[model samples]
Target: MTTDHPRTPGPRPTGATIVWAERVTKTFTTPDGRELPVLDDIGFHLAEGEIVALLGKSGSGKSTLLRCIAGLIAPSSGTVAYRGEPLTGANPGVSMVFQSFALLPWLTVQQNVELGLHAQGVGEQERRERALKAIDLIGLDGFESAYPKELSGGMRQRVGFARALVVEPDALLMDEPFSALDVLTAENLRNELVGLWEGHEAPVKSILIVTHNIEEAVLLADRILVLAANPGRIQAELRVDLPRPRNRQDPHFESIVDTVYGILTGREDAAVAAVEPTTTGGAERPAPTPTSAPLPEVSVGGLAGLLEILVARGGEDGLAEIADELNFEIDDLLPLVDAAELLDLARTEGPRIRVTDAGREFAAADILTSKQLFAHHAASRAPLVRAIVQALAATDGHTLREGLFLDLLRRGFSAEDARRQLDIAIDWGRYAELFDYDSGDGELTLDPGAQDAL
Candidate 1:
């Protein structure tokens, strides 16, 4: 989308101040002539060398705001400026990393990383050097020749990061970049990223990340901008005063998480209860105020029951597979499977599925029944585990396992904890092998044994 806004001629180059969004508002006119306002009176500034996180629930216009700043979509009633000049369409100095990774499956890792540079018309040798540097920087040293399908979830994200970085963008915009990975791998990458950012001689001038995860906001953001919807607007701005390399267990960190949660849930409740009643016959009947109810308790027993059904069907299951086996429809099967998966009663591998060790224990009555045992486990432990799995999955042939670890840290993890967990998962869990970690350089990776737990 090209903009008619004239470029300001000056001796100054772009990237001097980074980004400025002033009173930006975006509205979309639907095909049926309905008008939808996505952002309202939004404003923010990203100074050079700063990382600001945009935090909100889905539909809160965080992504919309990011796109507006990127010049992917124009705002209806406000101006966005980069280094004092009004932004037009896609600026050469700005780049975005999407949540989905969006790597081309047909392309090799090197080719994918070099795409932006190629578009910018860089020479072949320069492109190769830059791409390799980005690859190495992201810890994908050897897998340049490997295809997307050969890499894992976390590794693919690195490729996405590399692609953006290779172009030497002055500002980076990420929309939930770590949301897709398992928890462990996400933490590893988060830590690694912190180190990389800290050690950089010339940093990406500014970063804007959009995320739903409250912990992520606290961990990675210098300032967290909380957005509200129903005509999206900035609700709150939180300065993360915690020191760099934040601790999740810290009281300050937990307080911020709680505050954000309260803001989201409280707003939802108020919105629901504020609906007005229809008048009839010149008399008013007050609308019923909706009451908030706590979520229903889920149990290991329930998870085991669902797992039994899945196992009975030989584990080759999709929503349809479970539905047909149990004589349930797609909707009916969702809650059961979701609850079971939440409790770790089952592990899904693409279309095929199986009961995890925890699930098996529950099914055999070796584990005690409890309300929301699975939910608690997932909240406390699953994030890290899933991250590791995703990192391993995303490696392609280029990135070593250690690079995956660093990437997770960079995404936002306690550095010491991230390293320790990787070691424990490898040594005790027998999940994978850790090749090496050099203080001067970064991590290295090696192959793991069969039957190693993930």
Candidate 2:
């Protein structure tokens, strides 16, 4: 873990480079003699102080790339180098944070954070001091004696982060570190991590994160590397140009999210696949179109049509039954119901759904399906609430209400102000409510109110 920091910046002079992968590739062979290519001539670079995100669906070669860079597995072809030297084995200057938060259950939080230094044969007192400093940097003060079992999920992840920081590696590799946490906690952690990266005046100069979450990628990455599966390869690279502290509700942000969503959902492929050839032509060609024409008057009457259908039906089962009666697929029903739900035009309960108080207001006002309502709901206050609920849901099962706040911190919340926000969400916002806490087992559940909100 302790390696001599390079004196000069830029590429090395000894005919080696900082980190280079020349047409790197990997293939896995099954026992049945079938060969599967996991990576195919993928190439990228990491410059000093740059944060790069590897984004794709599962089996897109993100993990394989990290492992290849770490030298855990040799590439079937291509060369990987560290500091102008070919990496044949594990590289000391690179450290990784796994998604699972791989902490030792038997070890104290401080001890777990200091394990990297311990493995390096650092003296006990020195390791303790370094570990403490790292923990304090992450705002885990006064939790030195806490064991993994006693700490919350978020706290455990913080310990994982502290351990990675204590080593002071030149490059940090994170494999979906925030994906396992709840949305609120993840957002808090993301904010804090960005702040730390901006303020750092240290030797650690580069970061590479692997994730499938489009928002996470856009929020944190300087550049996103999109990979495709079936012999994983770089499909596209997008530079996120938005300024920091990005507003999720911003129109531009929504546009990017939608574009990325399209990419992920295979909608783009479907659109491509839908192209058809012209009949009775020497060469099949696209239909000729007018260069200019008056735009057609657009109306969202379809939404009103949907609302009428929902109102005619009495309950959640009624909505589903109507959908079935009309032969509407789930996808066809989602947008209409979501629109109605967001607009307060409908309320759903278990298998029964109906119009709500706001829906009645819209109907009375004859506001048929204003485009404004769609925008308002799309960029509504619900995202923040949804973010909170998503975080709570990540606990695997139930968790103490206090544990949720701590989990947010571990995901990267500043310990200074997150507690106040948590209180507001639980006490007033109605996003979540405290149920019961057991002092003996530290187990907790959500209140009926919280479940109802969900």
Residues 171-235, candidate 1, lDDT per residue (tens digit)? 89999999899878888878776655554522376678998877788888877887875456877
lDDT of 2: 0.62
Q: Against the hidden reference, what TM-scores do the models get? A: 0.57, 0.57
Question: Which candidate has the highest TM-score of all?
Answer: 1
- Kindly report which residue stretches of model 2 are placed more than 4 angstroms away from their true locations once superposed: 1-17, 201-203, 266-454
Q: Model 2 over residues 86-202: C-alpha lDDT tens digits?
A: 888987778888899999889998999989999999999999999988888777888999998888777788888889888998778899998788767877777877766655523
lDDT of 1 at 337: 54
Relative to the true structure, how large is the alpha-carbon lDDT of every model? Answer: 0.64, 0.62
**Model 1 TM-score, all chains together:** 0.57
TM-score of 2: 0.57
- The clash count for each model shown is 44, 11
CA displacement after TM-score superposition, residue 193 of candidate 2 (Å): 0.5
